[model samples]
Target: MDNPGSQEVDRIERQESRAQDLHLDRVVATQPEIGPTPPDGGYGWLIVVSASIYHITVPSLLTLYGLVILRAIRDEEHEEEESLKIWDMDLALVPIIMLVIRLLLESWCRAVVKIFNMPRFMALAGLCLTVAGVLLSSYSTDTYSNDHIVNVFAGIFAGTGCALTGQQTDVIITHYFREKLTIAQRLVRMAPSIGNFLAPILIGYLCTVYTGDVIVMIYAAILMQNCLFLASYTRPIYIEKVIRTTYNMLRDAADDDDEVIYSNPNQPTPAPTTQNPQQGTSQDDDNDVVVFNSRKNAREILDPAVQYRERSEPVNNQARFSSDFSAMFAETSSNRFSSNFGSLDVINYTSTSRYQELESIDRDSQNPQPLYRETTVNAPQNNIVFATEPTAGTIRRTATLKKNLITIANMLMDINFYLYALLHLSTTFSILVLGVFFPAYVWLQVPSQTIWWVATTIAMGHGAALCFLMMCLVLPQNINEKTRLCAAFCFVGALGFYGITISGNRSFLILWCMCASFSTAASSILQQPLYNSTLNEFDTTATITTTNAIVAAFVLTWALLKNYEYSTCFLTAAILQAITAVIFFALSFRRRR
Candidate 1:
């Protein structure tokens, strides 16, 4: 009798304390989830600038190797006889080596991006290797007594370096410039064309006025400058959503029908399914009905306290998993990265909102328990921001690998892939033949004025390369227009090269050489549009590999038939180009039909 009133008051006071705890816990658990901002053009443009520097320097050095060696050999009267033996045959392999390295290392390079967790670091490393290779070649060329040794070492080092640096640059640029991708690519490609245009003039001047030492030194300095630009590529920005929580709809044992109970934390989840109107329930109600009915029918479920415990327990499990994953990966405390290059403070509140809904469901059933955990997802920023954890990154990369393989497999089945491949093969073969044999062809046929014809042919070829770049830059971004131009140019190129094989007149040869140069440049330019139209990256890779293989085949075949007359080589190039034009026209016709 003395404490009955006090006991009743104490019971009410305890209930009030529990309710306050629940409210605080709700606030904590419902905290917003922050994520990385999407990439728009701020620091991304900086990447384009850096890539352009490398584009200009590296390809200029690479593409000019043949011309540089030829000029050196011709100028060195003492070595003129030996030059043909050492320079001509071996120089053909440089582009082949570089392009093959690019073709083979595509998968390995993609892995490097995932494993390093920092593309900028990988890019810097590649730049360093390129610098080292350039220095080694420069040193060897200056000191080495043997011309063969100099060409061999220089080609190996320079080719390897260009391969490494060029691949990384392409990947970085493609990652950053999605919105104005066409314009960005045109700018980057233009750099190489500019390099090709200028490299020959530079080499000719260096050989005629300065020495080989001075030429090699200049290239090393240019490549070193490229390193400064590459340093700005700090980190990669991911566009896809992070913090995905999947929920699976398990079949109900009683009904033998699918029910999304939302009971388990680890179950495989499908996206929200469509609601059945005949049930007179919304999608949300349909999802929870199974769990609601189970709680109502079971005696164990009647205990409100036990039901609350069940719901909170699952949430706690999820929180732990997320916490562990984040900690393991050394990511920002909140799954999002707050970056200066893009918008910040943006949070994906789906997880928080869903948690609150689950908590409310528990409360509605008249079940109450202590919200034991604070459930605060600590929001700390990182200087080096990556999109995912190591495990998640690995899984995603593995999945991407599977997708690439499947896509490649599908392309193998597609007739269009082979058709395009053949067209690229023959066209690229023709284009490379110009660089490989045209200069030599001019030197041989017009020996009385070798210097003039060689210089003019090289100038016109690179001049056409520059013009092609400019056209792609200025033209409307219409695929049909590009296709029409490519066809017109290629047909003209075929006619010119065939004429070159038969024509002996010096003036006519020069004119036809210019025509072939323009057509080859235009044909090469068409590849950019073709790759852009492709649905898969692997398909682009396939086209590149096919083109390189065909070019390599031509180079090796030429080496085997070294005894063949120069005219025979020119005739072969013309035949291949003519075939390419036919295939392209046939492909275009089929597409129209």
Candidate 2:
């Protein structure tokens, strides 16, 4: 290395080569002519933390968890006779419809984000909606025959809050810490686990000890209100400091260095004005001023152009080197980088969550293509968590669809995402319609029917769990592995449970659910990883959803339409598994190539 002030500018070439080996080098960054930074830092982490807690506490409470107990509106509730009748098929869809509506509404909210960049306002709107929604739910004991109507209202409030808060938080994190992405995101992802770990037990204890409806309502209200109040702490993300564009000025400065030529056998050469700076550095000539403040943080470091344009300061730098880095906000004003500096280009690296959000200069050098590598960082925690932008060296071929055609096609393409939901509903419906087939069938056989049913069910659940786990691992979006693993383990543990055939005769449905959920964890884990990696390759075409839908449609139709008869359901499931497993295996390998 040369003296800090005299390092060669050409060293950028070497660093360019090095970029290829870094994982970031693999992705192509989509660079708009100018890039925009998200609002980041300050209270962003607080928002993520709050959201995590909220998600953990509220979402966990369903009829199953009994976090909130319903009033005996059942006793006075007109419109229904028996409690069992009240809990019938029509009412069961309340939560499901609410969730669906919420997702749809949230999608609408996401679309409007471009118009509302104000984080504080967004957060406030979300908080208010949440409070209102819950309050409304409290009032609607038997309000509507369609359970979906009430549920949708509640879901919309919560879902929109989550979506809006998430955007604000993400932008802020991007502004604050561009480097500690992976660690920060993992912390955000930890929210659910952290909240759920104790919520269940605490709520359970509260439910057991407090039998009164009023007290139970009070407790639930308190919990919710506390969460709502804490939501304020999430805060809006902001960046006070700004770094303006200076690459052009820096490049010009480097170019002004004295040039020497050895021509016509031998020629006298002018001495060098100064060697140019390298990939992350600066140097200067009489007309140019170099600024090198190595000790300053990235945001605080004065841009090279800023230094060249600033007025000179009276203070002298120490031998060890120090400068008024805080006061060095020169923008484009001429000023020297008074502190120790080295390198050619001022890399201007920005980071988020896990990956560095930037273009790979290495790929640029190799092909020198017209396409620029670009990467965008979404600083949020989701089931999928990879950078959204495509990789470098990739040729983007976005399918140009006729608008009319796409509109027509989209209406028919619901099968992909909708198939799973359909299967779930159909499975339940089949069991109901069959009128409790298993236990009755088993009553005739006695004890032998119980063991065989239990054993087969357990085996199915075990296999299903394995399949889910594998898929999850393969899924590329890098969802929180710990959570996925925990879910997987729970499925596996559930396999130990015994079930009597629905007929009292012993059939394998309970065991079946366990096994399917378990096997699903394998596929589920791999699912995001595979999707993510392939996304880098395929962009956002219908590859994953299409494949899953095609496979699922066959499996679900066969399994459900056949009426879930234990006699042949397992055989259908086994064959479905064998075929899709092969297809998935093949698809999973594509990214590696």
Candidate 3:
């Protein structure tokens, strides 16, 4: 049955191969790959909640560090020895090389995830490399080559952990609530603020108390280990369902064989064509209807995106089982009757299931190389191809840039953006009042010497957050989602310094903060809508990522070069942000051809 299509035949002989995994038994026992429909007992939500518990603490600390800290660090270290000045004080006293090491680790972590089967080993290797970097850096007495101290331990290890876990966190949660990604992201972004709003004050208090870096390092190390404990809760779910689906697809393909046995008249005997199914079957539960049906059930399960669960009354168990029974019965017949490789076993979705699969290998699948070789672009799945059509549940995927869910997500995210700015603004004004006009001002207690610590913390925060967002966007399916979020994440990094100016009451700082906010607001307003409206995740991902990166980087970089000072730098950024916002607004309103 060489690629048999539209053939009517009997006694199909099919065999398929499957591979090793840590949770093969769970795969065999549970209907794990249960389908687009929400599964019963709904523990996926529980996992989502658990994952968010950890993720909520990550965002803020990464996003806005440099805003309040950088100006003081560089100013103090300006005339210092080269070794002391090697790293930007505002960037967490992290050497320039540590920055490079971090970027490398970010990419490597993504590489590991796309190689899904190798996650355990790859993650371990990442951990080793990171810890080693830290261990080596311990010998550094000065900042010149301090990156060696940063190499394996904190930068490499933490970078890898951030990239891998951040993306995995999204993927796992998305599996449970793909439709709710934007909302979930908005909620998760606040986690950092919750954890870190007090962290600075605590650091200040501790510094006042201990008056040394040693206790600070000890406390920081303890915090990092605690975060690792939270990380342990994250893992892959529903993997077995994926393996089972692949297995059955291949099994149907194997059914294609010679229908006619060659007759040798000179031979002593002729062999019978039909082999007994009962005799050849394995000792495994191949004969069990429930076992075979579970995989089929997930595939056959009507997507809740289109057909949601019945809400009027309690969902009838018998009715669900009945629906399950019918689908399995249909699949059994299809498999049993197949005489060719082309006879698909997909009961309701054979057409889409096959065509969609032509491109649907995981980013990590060993044999299939990525289509966009330079960029790690994952292909579409068979189920998703068919499901891609717009419906109420999926209408957000079809909305225009302004109308899409991503746009809404961006808008919702602004709640935090605005709040963060406002908080910083209040802090800045109070500080300015103290610094410029009156020494008696209470808020003036923030201290000029510790300003470097503030600035460096903000820089480190922005870098860490931006790196996290970038890797997540670039690593998975529908690259557009990643890109959109990446750009959104990068926005803060671009304008971070302005917030500092607003707080300090420097000559230009006020204008800079205002403009920076405007620019970020405008970018989000324009870019997110386009992402929302576009259908092709690839097209959206590619277009938005490139566009946002180019546009956002240019604006931010120009601002940086104009003023590297606390007051003037931020003030300049504010003007640029405002101008960028105006340009974006004008473009957004213009009539398109």
Candidate 4:
């Protein structure tokens, strides 16, 4: 016969066990679904190809403004002083307005992704808008009267399209490649440089052959080819839906009940099990076994005891338990158990302490007993059922939204991230300001015979820079070092701009163009890697939007200053680059100390 004290202990043990099971059930029911692992290769290469095409086409359009679009607009300008003022404003404002529209669209990219559901669809929509904008700009003949207004709308549409296409392409490429991400990024980065190198030569040649409107239409036709390439690629890899459990909360609750639960803090948290009403007994039933169907396999059972017994079986063949309670309490814990479910150990009720040492669990070696027995009955072919309550879904979405908001807020608060953004914006601002005004400067200052020679020199410089960046990517330098090197290159480019201000010699100007293009290419290639290494939590969409907004503000200030003089513009760009370089050097020095 059992002693009265023994009976009381057994009753308390049963109550504790029931409480743990209830807690697990509650946690599992509220958890969201986890996506399957990335294939990391497969059709992802095809995605890279499509993304390369997008980079080649969309971003390179901006480069054409200096060669073709701006020249066309300038040619249409009237001789009146008011017309010249309006033209000057258009030159400053067009790119700024374009950047502003792009900024706004990119900032709201998350919402756009939700609406479109896939990057391919978003790319398609952006393509249509871009083509329409090009056609609209081509329709206008006068610059001061109708073309200026039409060009603003054109910039808007083009900016919107470019933002959507660029952002969505990034998402698709990132989603596809994991292990080979660096290689893929290098290849994609190379595309823009290739485009920049080739676009000027192509546009310059086309301008000499075809009229401006004809050239615009021809480019629009070229842009339309992306639709074909995009459609050829298949959808992204299939993701398996698995429950995500909150292990920390379970651990805390276990501690509150004076039950010890063992878990490796380093191990990933495991998914918890929900009480399945269809394939298993009701909560009121006293049966010791429970069975549930996984979405991936209908015949699979999620029993920890069964999983432990078949531990020697291949991972693909083993049942995917919500939590491997048995394995968690095994003699030697392995990383295998932690991979599926977060690390967890069976509850130890003997100790009043919330956490007992692993060595203290000697009862398992002396007289082992399974936490629960498994009965393997055939599971019916049914879908993985989830909580049908509307409130649960709403609550989960609200939590996700709140978490994202907090993350963005935290990123915004970080001084390092803010400084990094300023550095990027300053570099981009100088590049744009130079690119927009450089052609006009050349036309005015350099002799007519040297203009085409200067254009060829610029194209060759871009090509050489592209090749150099490709070589740099292949080298073994770390991101931090590469970023510093790029900053130094910016300083060198600033010196190049200053040289341009001091001399109108074609040979010197050619040298300056090469330096500037080299800096531009290097900055473009390293930007993503630096962002990833510095602030992994910050969203790419948000970064682009924030930087572009700041750039637009700077451009607005320049416009208001009414400093369109070529010498002043080049001087201003050089000053901004110098400041950016100095700040980066200071920040890097402080970080090292």
Best by lDDT: 4
Ten-residue region with minimum lDDT total, candidate 2:
432-441
User: TM-score for model 4?
Assistant: 0.63
Candidate 2: lDDT of 356?
Answer: 45
Q: TM-scores of all models?
A: 0.58, 0.42, 0.44, 0.63
Candidate 4: count of backbone clashes, pairs at least 3 residues apart or interchain? 4
Candidate 4 or 2, higher lDDT: 4
Model 3, position 24: C-alpha lDDT score: 48
| Runs of candidate 2 exceeding 4 Å displacement | 1-47, 63-86, 89-94, 140-152, 155-183, 209-531, 536-593
- Residue 60 shift from truth in candidate 4, angstroms: 2.2
Candidate 1 residue spans exceeding 4 A from truth: 1-40, 75-95, 131-156, 236-409, 426-431, 436-440, 448-457, 481-485, 496-510, 534-570, 591-593
Q: What is the lDDT of residue 101 in candidate 3?
A: 37
lDDT to native, each model: 0.56, 0.38, 0.37, 0.63
For residues 1-593, could you state the per-residue lDDT of candidate 4 as single tens digits? 87999999999999998898765323323333533345577888888888888778766666655655345544655232322222353434445566667766776765676465566678788888877776666654234434567778887888788777767776677666666788788788778777877877777777677766677788889889889877744445342122113565566666552211232234334445457777673222112234332333333222455456667554445444435454643445433445443333223232212323333444456764322111111212221212344688899999989977877787788765766676676666666755566665655554353335545756776776676666756744355564466569779878877877776676777777666766766766677677767776677556666666776677666666664565677787788778777777666666531
lDDT of 1: 0.56
- For TM-score, the strongest prediction is 4
| lDDT for residue 334 in candidate 1, whole number 0-100 | 28
Q: Higher TM-score: candidate 2 or 3?
A: 3
> What tens-digit string does per-residue lDDT give for candidate 3 at 221-290?
5334434433343333455556676788879877654222232233333334445677573222211222
